[model samples]
Target: MLLVSLILLGAIGTRLAVLQLWQGHIYRDKAENNRIRIVPKPPVRGNIFDRKGRVLASTRLTHAAYLWPIVVKQPDWPKNLKYLSQLLSIPEESIQSRIEQAGYNSPTLIRIARSLNPAQITALEEFKTELNGLEVDIETVRDYPNKAMGAHVLGYTGELNAEELKKRQAEGYRLGDIVGKMGVEKAYEQQLRGEWGGIQLEVDGAGKVMKVLGQKVGQPGKDVTLTLDLDAQRAAEAALGDRKGAIVAINPQTGGVLAMVSNPSFDPNVFSSQITPKIWKQVQSKGNPFVNRALRGFPPASTFKLVTATAGMESGKYPPNTILNTFAYLNVGGTAFGEWNRAGFGPMGYVRALAWSSNTFHGQIGRGVGGPTLIKWARLYGFGKATGIELDEEAPGLIADDAWKRKNYNWEWTDGDTVNMSIGQGFTQASPLQVAVMFAVPANGGYRVKPHFFDNNQDTNKWRTSLHLKPTTIKTLREGLRAVVAEGTGKALNVPNLPPVGGKSGTAEAPPGESHTWFGGFAPFDNPTIVVVAFGEHTGGGGGSTAGPMVKQVMEAYFKNNKR
Candidate 1:
């Protein structure tokens, strides 16, 4: 009896010692976890400002309700959801969806409702002890004070999805992190989204904060300053009001985007918070309201005439004053292509053909330049590609040659194709931004300025290229463009008392749709300071009537406001 008692006592003592010394930490940790809660401290989103320090985007603070799944059971949701619905007035289904989105096993707390009002916050606080898995905390949401003024430029933000979270998990982005979805917000996302931190909290069994353990406030994101001029943007949009069009105003010397306006813009504030299904549907209603038309492709119309004229003089095939014969239309392969006027400008020089926008005359020039050279010159002017701006949606406008045609359509290039391309028709297309860049060549003395939304303190040689164009060619092109506004096709832009304007007006036939009108102009023609390109999609009217006036308004605004 004594030996047996000794063995029993020894075994019991050994077991107790093992538990206390070796395996005690595991159970202690479990107990500690049950009593502790971690509250997240979200970093404030950065502000966005225009060149003049006008606020374009910022962050506003609000309260949000969170759910900690650790203490909440699966069966408890229906009753708790009902209680929450009654108190907070949020739909039970939405709360369920948020819970499901975060999953029951989410390591971090799940935010079920955001932008909570004071009433909702108070109700949640008053019933905190009875509510399970419910937590209230401070949240930050994006705010656009200007609303849709620069929506395309200053894109909105949204929570990170499953895929985005997974991809950025290694980068330390949490599942509920806010990320930029478009425009400058997207372009500089890394620089704009700052580091995140958390608050280590100790709470009672009811998920109420009992004591503060530790806290590390998150770092706010860096503020971004854009090159946009708010005054210029407002003027441009006002001028383009309600039209299915876009307008771009740029610095001729630096290629800085003074203003970029796309009509039918969506208010980014609608996306600043939780987007309702009805709001999403409404946003998608119009023809892609978010698409920046300034970056989208359209027929260059007569704006492409500058390319043809450049090809004409650069090839040394057609000199500055060399007269080219033109008539109502040029007939080839038993087909006659008609000009804007049935009676053409007859025989004329480069300056006259450009001023009159003589289709037949440009056709003769196109035939002389051939397809390959015209494509080369256009490519040199930065057509058929993106301008490498801060945005990603810029369309590389199409400029196909014989090889492209053969590959895509199994056909060879023809003189008719060249004629159409010369006048910025057929397969040739250019964005309003591209047109602005194209016109910048002569405005800044034979340099192709790379268009940019951010300030361009960049090296001059890097952002712009010297075309090395002949002096005579530059002289002829500038003279011809000036003549366009002085007395010819774009005469509508020659408003009295305004700075001298030089521009080209293009009207391209769209066949199934109305013709697209384009006006690419530079102000103070002698020593140009700004380039403004205005486009009217399927507007039916000519460039001078349809688009030139838009350019005039923007130019007036820029000059008048800037006092330049």
Candidate 2:
């Protein structure tokens, strides 16, 4: 009996030792984990500045109203919800539903309102003691000082939804965090979004933050200084007027984009905050205001004649003085094409034909240069490829070849297609940005520059390192382009302040009776300073008539500001 009793005592002691010592740390850890909370602390985003140091985009502190459902007393919930809803301009039912959905066990923050003005915040603070559920917190929100100016370039920020959060979680983004949605904001998200920091606070049983245990301050994002001259941008947009089109201006020496204007732009400030369903529907329902026409593909029209000129000259098929007879119309492969002026120059040299933008001249040149040479020169000028700008949704235009036609449409190439392409017509399209770069090459002595918006300060080196043309070819092309603007179709819109501006004008026939007018040019023909391209949709006239004046006006403003 004694031995059995002793054994029983030993077993009890072992069990007690296991519970008191062996498993103590595990239970303590589980308890601590159950009570301890980890909340995300958002880092301060970087500031965006124009070249002149003007604040384009910044962040500011704003008051937000939230409900801590777990801490609210049952009897006070209704009164508190009503008071907060009325104060925040929100419906009382919404506040109640949010709280109920959050449940009592989970200490979730239910946001009632954001961007509360100082007066509203003051009024709410007075009742903080009485309303357990109501709380005021400071949060950073995006601010745009210039309203709608440079909206597309500056972009906007908004709260990350489920999908965005999931995609960017590896990049340090969290649910309910604000992220750059488009434009520069989206492109430089990593550089613009700095490291996030947080404060570790000891909380009471009621979820009220007590004395701060530890704090980690957030680092501000790096400041981004752009090369955009707001003055030039404003002038370009203004000159564009109510026309539905785009204007792109670049520095020929550096490839720095000075102005990029797409008319009918939206105020990015509207998107920075909470966008209403009504406003969203209106923006979406409207006719393509969101489409950035500067980056979109359109028919090159007569502006593409420069490519034909290049092919003809390089292939030794035509000299600068080569003469071609121009009639009112010409038939190739039984399809007739005519010049803008019903009566063409009876007999004109190659230079005069280009000066007059004679369609007959180009048609013949196309047939003479043939398809292979035309395609080669077109590819050399960077057509049928993306311009490699930092923006999203860029389209590589169609460069049609016999093989392409056979594979895609199962048709053979003909003189009609060749003639059409030579005049910048059927199966050929280019973005305004592309045309501007194309013009810049010959204007700047044959260095084909990749146009870019962000100013890297190293743009000159970048351009020099990546230039894609022979010096002789660039020089020859420059003279032809110079003549086009000096005495050719582009002369009428030349600005006196700009020295020897060279350009080409094109009137692309749109679908059934409409036309898209285009003007692409570069200034100081001998030593180029700037290159500009403008396009107007459904403009009844040629590039010289419709798009030329706009480009001239923008260039005039730009030069006026610089005053070299």
Candidate 3:
């Protein structure tokens, strides 16, 4: 009996030694965790503004539901999820995804649901103990007061998924972090998303908060001021009205984007909250409303004549006064490419040729200049590449030369192809923004300006390369474009009280569908300030009748607020 007693006493002493000396730190950590709690607080997202100081995007605080992974044991997880699913009307699957997104052993509170209703909030509060780990807190969400206006540019935000979290984890991004999905919001994400903070608390053994400790209250993101003009944007949208197209207005001298609009734009506010399955499917519907046509590539049609005209004059072959026989049609290989007029106006010079948008005249010039020179000039004018705007989606329109043809279609370049190229047909394409940048060259004294939204320290004005065209080339192209607005196809811009304008209009034939139309020009031609371009996709109408009035509307609206 004495030996047995001695053995039991030694066993007890050994257990105490192990707990006190070896496993002491682990138990101390567990005790500290029982007393300490941290509720992460997201910094208020930055506000977005236009140059006029009007708020374009801001944040609003709302009740949000958070789940503490530490408090919710694996055994209690299913029932707690059931409670949350019934109370918040969130699907069980969605709750599970959110949990997985934050990680099963995440030390921080995971945001499961937001934009909670009053009834749901009351239920969460009443059943707090029954639903382990769930808590109600304040959360900031993105808000767009203008709704769908400028939606493509403002973009939207959403919670981060597991993959997004993994990539952003190094940057301190956690699950449930709201992030910009597209547009300006996405282009400058780092500048727009500031630092995050946390709420410290003193808690009891049951994880109930006993005392408020303190907060780090992290810094908010810097405000982003864009070159977008509210007045011009409204006007452009009003002008576009339900049409499937895009319109762009720019300050020609500075390359500042004044206004941009894309039709069939979705309401970005929908993304600020939980997007229902119906809304998600609708967003993915036909026409893909999310496509920002302003930055998207389309057949430039007659608008591309500006490039053709430049290519023609720069080649030293077709001078300003050079005349081309503009008879009804020009025979190419086996095909007879007919002109717009059944009986073409004969013996036209460069000025009148551009004013008339003479396809045959340009085609002859294309034949004279050859393909390489035209492609070179086109590339120099910013075609075949992105315009370098603050967008991830800008399409560098196709500028197919002989080599491109060999690789893509395995076909040889032909004179007919050159003729088609001269007329802005075949593989050539440009976005409305690119077209604006093109016209800005002649508008701003031969400077190839980089179009932009944010001033980024006003470097955009200096972000230019000289075109260095001959004095005669610039003069002839400018005069021809002037004659277009003054007496040719772009006469629609000749409204009362408006300054002198210069532009060109054209239509590109799209066989199974109707033609795409385009109008690109500058207002106050003598000292151009604004370069506007309007593109009507599959409109079938002539550029003069379709896109011309849209440009007129933007110009008139801009001039209204910005009096010269």
Which of the predicted structures, 2 or 3, would earn the higher TM-score when compared with the native? Answer: 3
Clashing pairs in 2: none
Reference-based lDDT, residue 331, model 3: 89
Candidate ranking under TM-score, highest first, comes to 3, 1, 2
Candidate 2 per-residue C-alpha lDDT over 1-564 given as tens digits, one digit per residue, 9 for 90 to 100: 999999999999998899779998876764453344333357788988877777889987877877655556688877877777677767777666555544653344555677887878898889878875566788788888887677777778876665676788897765456778888888788888887776665566655666666677788788888878877888888888888888989877777778888867777777655455677777766467667788788898988988887777777787565778998888887788987798888887656666678899888888998998898888878889998877785678878999999999899998888889999999998888888888877777666777776666773757643335545556656666666777878886555666668788899999875799999888767677888899997767878878988889888888788775
Misplaced by over 4 Å in model 2 are 1-40, 67-113, 117-134, 459-461, 464-476
Candidate 1 minimal-lDDT segment of 10 residues? 99-108
**Candidate 3 lDDT, 1-564, residue by residue in tens:** 999999999999999999988999977776676567788888788999998999999999889988877666788888888878877777999899888766676557888888888998898898876765778998889999999899988888887777888898998887678888899999888988888899888887677779988888888999999999999999999989988889999988889999899987888888877666787888777468889999988777766777778888887787777877797888888767678887898998988988888888888888788888878888898988998888888889888999989998999888888888888888888888988999998898888889889966666548788999988888988999999988899999987878999888989898898998889889899999999999888888899889999999999988889998
True lDDT of residue 334, candidate 3: 75
In Å, residue 335's CA in model 2 sits off its true spot by: 0.7
**TM agreement with the true structure for every prediction:** 0.93, 0.86, 0.96
Q: Is candidate 1 or candidate 3 better by TM-score?
A: 3
Overall lDDT per candidate, in order of appearance: 0.85, 0.77, 0.86
